[model samples]
Each structure stands twice: as structure tokens, then as C-alpha cells.
Target: MTHVMACIDNSQSSLAVCDYAAWASQRLNAPLTLLHVLDEEKYPAAADLSGNIGLGSREHLLEELATLDAQRARLALEQGQHMLEKARERTVISGAAFPELKQRHGHLVESLSDLQEDIRLLVIGRVGEDNSRNAHSLGSQIEAVVRTIHRPILITATSYKKPEKVMLAFDGSSTAYKTIQMFAASSLCKDLPIHLVTVGADSVSNHEALGKAQSMLLSAGFLVQAEIRQGEVESALHDYQTEHGIDLLVMGAYGHSRIRQFLVGSTTTTMLRTATMPVLLLR
Candidate 1:
């Protein structure tokens, strides 16, 4: 069965990721899996000791290094197991049913991609272990996973709160419409109030687009408050979220040409960095 998978690490956001995953699992009535990956790039099994060793002692030093690397790999495996167990316990306490624990040795994106077929939704921390100290820095793996995985991803904050209100950042693009359709079809946030916001000029076409999107949600039995805000996209959405106390933000990820997104960056990335609440990103 497809499960809600959460990437767990020893970062500050790990707990929040678990909590949010539990919440999503319950809402969708899906199984949960806590995945801990020992990234080869971060935890390699071999190290270069050639520079430090002299000609005569090179073989001995290499043997010692091999032993040390094996020991380090074992330690990393043990730590990952412990983290998965802890995350599973926390999810159970948060009211989710028994969750599965998985540990893999590889790059995070590769591991996730390999298991993408079985993933209904993916939840991960906004910042990873390396970037957890800096609030403004985005996790290194976030964009790579976003670009590679076609599944929906929930990038969580450093903390989790039961979501009270949901805001959909709509831009009248095809991606935005698809986001609305996907959200309406799922049970993830069905009963919460929806704020359908468009950050652009209040032209007739924009109003029509907003109205159309709002109608789609209303037809799906959602309580939607549609509005068109003026100003930059990120700033306008942030202001509305703050004003309305939105607990979760939903939007399409990378809704521009590949070159354009690369050249100018993506609003999705900006929102992930700046938003205090959890963000559900749809491709």
C-alpha cells in the first residue's frame, strides 16, 4: 500500500517532520514509514589516507583506515536505527498507527526516488543537519528531491502544530489549477478553511481565474475565501498568511520554465525558506 514517508535525521526539524507525517497519515488513512538515510556523501565508507602516510607505513595506514571506516559505518547504521525507532515512537504517541522504519545507505534523493512508487506523500524537514543552524538557508537536498520526485512533498518547519487554517497560493496557471484539483480530491486537509489567494493585479482575467479556482474548491465542499492581493508574490502571500493566521500553505512547486526557474530562482523555494508554517508542494 502507498504510505506517507517522512525523512528523519538528527536535525531540529526531525521531530516536527515526524509529527506532521503522523498527522498526514491519520488524515489520509494511510500507513506511515519513517525513513532514515545514511547519505554516502555525508558518511563515506572510504577515506583518502595516502597524503598522510609515508612510503614504508602506507600499507599499514591503509589497513587501519579501512578498519576505522568500517567501524564508522557501523556506528552510523546504529545511530540511524535509533533515530528511526524514536521517530516511530513519537508518531505512535501522536495517534498514528504502527509505522514502518526503513534505513538505507545512499544519497537521499536516490533513495527517495527508488521508493517513489510506494510513497503517497513525502514529508521532510525544511533544513537538514548541515543547514539546521541557519534559519534562512534552505536544505541542500530539498531542491534536488523536488526536481526529481514527482510526488507531493510536505516541507515542514522546525516545529509542528495541528493545522487550523490552509492557504492555497494560486496564480491562475495550469499548475495552480492542478494543485486545486489534487487538493480537492485528497482528504489531507478536507475540513479546514481554505484561503484561495492570487498575488497579482486585480484585473478581470485574474478575478475570473480566482473565481474559477474558488468554484472548484467550493464544488468539492470546501469553505474557500478567494482574494486577489496586490504586490510581489511571496510578500503578498506571506502577508495574507500572517493576517489570517494560516497554519499550512499549499502551492505548486517550480511553476516556471526550467531555465527561468534556474535563472531567477523559484517562488516555491523562497516560500519554503520564509514561511513559518508547513508547506504542501504539488508538482
Candidate 2:
């Protein structure tokens, strides 16, 4: 069975992510696993340790600091567990039978790496405390997973709405093709309309790529519409989604290194930061 994993932190955005994952689970006839990683390190208690003055003795201060850190870690774990339970219940209601709920007690990124082989797709909220708040950027944990894991990721934003229209960014790249396969095989595309889009500087390749993708999606039984647009990739996508009322944007993540993407301002980076809709990024 296909495995769809959702990273739940019990945040407002994470509830929407649960909804998306539940939809994917029912569509794929896949088992759902709601995962919560306690990023104990990110929740340092030093910020909350502002009460009485510390004793002059070194051992006393060290013990007090250790206790405070342990308390913070416990709180994070409890919250993470609560989020996982809620997410599991949501998926179960979506006809996902006996969904799995996992709570990891370590680094978020590392836990994801440990489960890479079993995970076909990782679902997450777009903006979290773990990620930077830059309008057009991915958070640190999501960025790390995209860079290291050779799997697909569905990144959702604050708003929660069932997908009505899906936009596919095709460049004829192998990774982009994999993204197309994900949508075609997903429940979101069963009898649903898909906009197969190709952005380029030259009209020839743009038209050819769009045609090829549209044909492929049609063969896979999707209602496909092809388009060739001219502009910077991110802006074109952002603009088209706004104009066409796209519900979900599906595309490939960058194959290049972090430094390389920053140097070139890759489309994945821009879309992650700027796109108004949810994005399903394939690696």
C-alpha cells in the first residue's frame, strides 16, 4: 500500500494539512500516517526562565537550567502527541482504515530522513515556526527535506479549501514528469480538470512540452488543458493561479543544491515563497 505521511505540529495550518492528506489517502487507497516530531531544541526554555535571580553557586544554576530544559522538552512532546491524535482522527474519518500515528522524540529533519524509504509523500504546512517567514521561501525543515529526501512533498498554506483546479508546471524534465504522475494518480484528479502549463522563453519548446504533457495526462484519464506561457517561471505561475482560480499547484522541486538555487533564484524557491495556493513538490 502507498504510504502518505503528514507532519503534524497541532498548529492552525497543520489542521488544513491533515485535510489534504486525508483526501490524498482516500484517493490513493493508501494508508495514512500522521507523524509528529518533537523539535525539542527549537523550544528552548531560556526564554521563559525569567523568574528569580540565579544563585551565585555554579552547581545550583546548572541543575536549575537542566530542569527547565527538561520541562520544555516534555511540553513539546505532549503537544506533538496531541497534534498526531487529532490528525489521525481526521484521516480515519476520511475512510482511511486504522491509520498510523507516530510521534518522534528528536529532530524533525532527522526523523523524516529515517522514514524516507517508507514514505512516498510527506505533507506539511507551508509556514511554521520551523520555517522562515519570507513571503516566497520554504522553512528550514521543509527545505532540508526537499534537499535530502527523494520523495514528493505537499506543502499547504494557512487557508483550507478542497482542490477544485490543479495547475501542473511542466518543463519536460524527468522530475516534473514524476510530479505529473503524482497528480494523475491522485484522487484530486479523478475526473477533475488539470491545467498542464509550460513556461519558456522560446515558443517552440513551450508548445511541444505542453502538448506532450497534455497528451500524457489525457491518456492517464484526466481532464487536461494545455497552455504555453512566457515569463519568469515563478511570476507566471503566481499570475496564472490568481487569474484562473487554481486550487493546487503541482510541480517539481529543484534538483540543484541549496547554493545553486540561491544563485539562480530557482522556480521552486520562488513558488514556495510566492504562490497563493497549495503546492505539491516532487523531487
Candidate 3:
């Protein structure tokens, strides 16, 4: 069965990820899976110290190094299992049904890719343990996952807040329309008031596109307030979110517009890196 999958680690955002995942699972009435990936690169089972080992004690040193590597790998695996169990307990406390636990040894994106077929929604932190120290930097895995995973992804902030209002950053692109269609079809966030906002010129075409999207949501029984803001896409959206007190931001993951550029581009914007609310990126 399809499920809401949350990627978690020993970061400040992991707890938030679990909370959001439970919320999504309840909203979508889907199973929840807590996934903890022990990156092989970070916790390798064997390290080649042959080059550095002196010739006299090479064999003994290699044996000791292998033993140490094994111990490290074991410790990592145990830690991941403990994290998964704790996350499951937290999810249950958050009012979600029992969630399945999964621990894998590999890259996060690769694990998500392999499990994408059964994922209804993916909830992850904006930054992982590796990047948690740098508050201003987006997790390196985020861009790769966004570019690779076709499923709807909820990139969460450092903390979890039960969302009351949602904003859709529409751009009138095909991907934006797809985002609208998906939002209208899904039960997730259907009970909340939605702000359908577009940051660009207030032209006839833009309004028409906005109207079309609004109509789609309205037909789906969504309370949508469509508006067009004038300024830079990122800044305008950020200001609108602040002014309106939006709790969650929704947008297409990829398109021809600046939104797509900032998301999967060479450089990620501060908006995503410093967003105070969760971002739901639809493919």
C-alpha cells in the first residue's frame, strides 16, 4: 500500500519531520513509514588503511583498523534502529496510527528512489544531520531528492507547527497547473483555507490562469483566495506569506519560471533555506 515516508536522522529537524509525517498520514489516511538511512560514505564498514600502515606492523594495524571499522558500523546501525523506534513512538503520540520502521545502509536519495513507487507523500527535513550545523545552508540531499523524486515532497522546517493556512505559489506554468490539479484531487490540506498567490505582472493572462486554478480548487470545494503580487518571485511570496500568516507554502517543484530555477538550480535561495514553515513541493 502507498504510504507517507519520512526521512529522519539525528538532526534537530528529525522530530519535526516525524510530527509532520504523522500529520500528513492522518490527513491522507495513509500508512506512515519512518526511514533512517545510515549513509555508507559516513559509516563505512571497511576503510583501506593499507597505504598509510607502516611495513613492519602493517598486518596487525590492518586487522585493528578492520575491527574498529566493524565496531563503528555496528554502532551506527544500532543508533539508527533506536532513532526509528523513537520516531515511531513520537508519531503514535502525535495521534497517528502505528508507523512501520525501516533502517537502510546507503545514500538517502537512493533509498527514497528505490521506495518511491510506494510513497504517497515524502516528508523530510530542510537540512539533515550533516548540514544541521549550518542554519543558512540547505541540505545537499534536498536538491538531489527534488530533482530525482517525482512524488509530492514536504520539506519541513526545523520545528513542527500544525498548519492552519496554506499558500500556493503559482506561476501559470504547466507545472503550476499540475500542482493545482494535484492539490484539488488530494485530501491533504483540503480543510484549510488556501491562498492562491502569483508573484508577477498583473496581466490578463496571469489573472486568467489564476482564475482557472481558483476554479479548479473551488470546484474541489476548497476555500481559495487568489491574488497577484508584483515584485521578485521569491521576495513577493515571502512577503505575502508573512503578511497573511501562512503556515504552509505549496508550489510546483520544477517549471520554466524562477521558482523552478531556485529549487533545482545552481544556487538555492534564502527563502527555502530560511523558510519558517513547511514547503509542499508538487511535481
Candidate 4:
């Protein structure tokens, strides 16, 4: 069965990520998997010992360093195990029935790609444990992971708030249209208030597109609101979300349409750094 896979890490957002994943799993009625990856580069087994040690003490020093490396590797393994267990506990507590837990040692992007086919949605923190220090920076693994996989990703904010309403940042692109259609057919957006927002000049073309989308959802018995606003996409959308109590954002990843293009731009990075709610990115 397809699972809502949560990428659990030692970030400040870890608990919130797990909770969001659990909520999503229950809401969608899908199974859950919590994965923790130990990147070798981040937690190296040994420091480089070449040319630094004096020739006389080299043999003894090398053996000592080897022993230390062994210890470090063991500690890292234990730490990762603990992280996964904690994530599983939190997920189950949040209402996931028997979420699967996994610990992997490798590049995170590669591991995600290997399991991409089995994942229906990917949940991750906007900023990871180490990268959380830089508030404005996106998680180091996010770009690479999104670039590698085509699955929808739910990027959690640092704080967990159960979402009551969802906003779709719509732009006139095949990808955005497809995303709207996909959500319209799924239970993920059903029975909840939806805000379909398009930011830019108010043109006939924009109106036609938004109108069709609103009409489609209304026909499907969705409580949908379609709004058009002017100015920059991020700022306008952010203000609207803040004013309207939007708790979840749904949008495409990248496209000629402005929303996804802006998503790949600096604005989305800024949003990730200071996002107040979860964002569901359609790839």
C-alpha cells in the first residue's frame, strides 16, 4: 500500500513533522512510515589522519583513531535508532495505527529515491536539525530531494497546528490544473474549506481559469472560495493567508505559471524560512 512517508530527523521541527504526518495519514486513511537517515558526511566515522601524525607515533595514533571511529559509528547508529523510535512513538500517539519505522545509513536523497515509488506523499521539515541555525535557509536536502522525485511533498512548519482550511496558490499551468483536479478527486481536500487564490493582474484569462476551477470544485460539492489579488505572489498570498486564517497551502512545485516559478525563486525560500503553517507542494 502507498504510504505517507515522514522524513524524521533531529530538527526542531521533528515532533511537529511527525504529528503532521500522523494527521495526514489518518486524514487520508493511508499507512505511515517514519524514516531517519544518518548521512556519513555529516557524522563521519574518522577525521583525516594523513601527514599530520609524526612518523614515530603513527602506528599507535592510527590504532587509537580507528578505535575512536568505531565508537563514533556505534554511537551514531544508536542515536539514529533512538530518533526513529521517538518519531514512531509520537506518530502513534497522534493517532497513526502502527506506523512503520526505518533507519537508513546513506545519502538521504538517494534513500528517498529508492523508496519513491512506494510513497504517496513525502513529509519533511522546512529546515533540518543542523540547518535550523540559519533561519532563512531551506533544508539542505530539500532541493535535491524535490528535484529527484515527482511525488507531492508536505513541508511542515516548526509549530504544529491542526489545519482547518486549505489554500491553493493557483496559476494557469498544466501542472497547477492537474494538481487542482487531483485534489478535487481525493479525500485530502474534501469536507474542508478551500481557498483558490491567483495573484497577478486581473485579466480575462486569469478570471476564466480561476472561474473554471471554482466551478469545478463547486460542482463537486466543495466549499470553495476563489480570490484574485494583485502585486507579488508571495507577499499577496501570505497576507491573504494571514488575514483569512489559512492553515495549509497547496501549490505546484515549478512551472511557467508564476506560483511555481516564484516557488523556485527567492520568495519561496523566504517563505520556508518564516512559514507559519504547513505547505503541500505538488510536483
- Give the top-scoring candidate (lDDT): 3
Look at candidate 4 and tell me the lDDT of residue 76.
Answer: 87
**Residue-level error in angstroms, candidate 2, position 88:** 2.6
Per-candidate TM-scores read 0.93, 0.83, 0.96, 0.92
TM-score: which is higher, 2 or 3?
A: 3
Worst 10 residues of 1 by lDDT: 257-266
- Which regions of candidate 3 are displaced past 4 Å? 48-57
> Model 2 misses residue 145 by how many Å?
1.2
What are the per-residue Cα lDDT tens digits for candidate 4 across 143-221? 7777787888999988799989999888877777787777787677688899999987899999999999888788888
Q: Model 1 off-target regions past 4 Å?
A: 46-57, 256-268
- In candidate 4 the C-alpha lDDT for residue 89 amounts to 87
RMSD of each: 2.7, 4.6, 1.5, 2.3
Candidate with top TM-score is 3
Residue 209 of model 1, lDDT score: 91
lDDT of 2 by residue, 1-283 (tens): 2688888875556777888888777766678888887765666534444544566646667668768787887788787787777777877775666778898877778898899888877888876654434535556566667777777788887667888888887777665666677666666558768887777766776577667778778988888888877766667777888888999987767533221342124234555766678888765
Q: How far is candidate 3 from the true structure (C-alpha RMSD, Å)?
A: 1.5
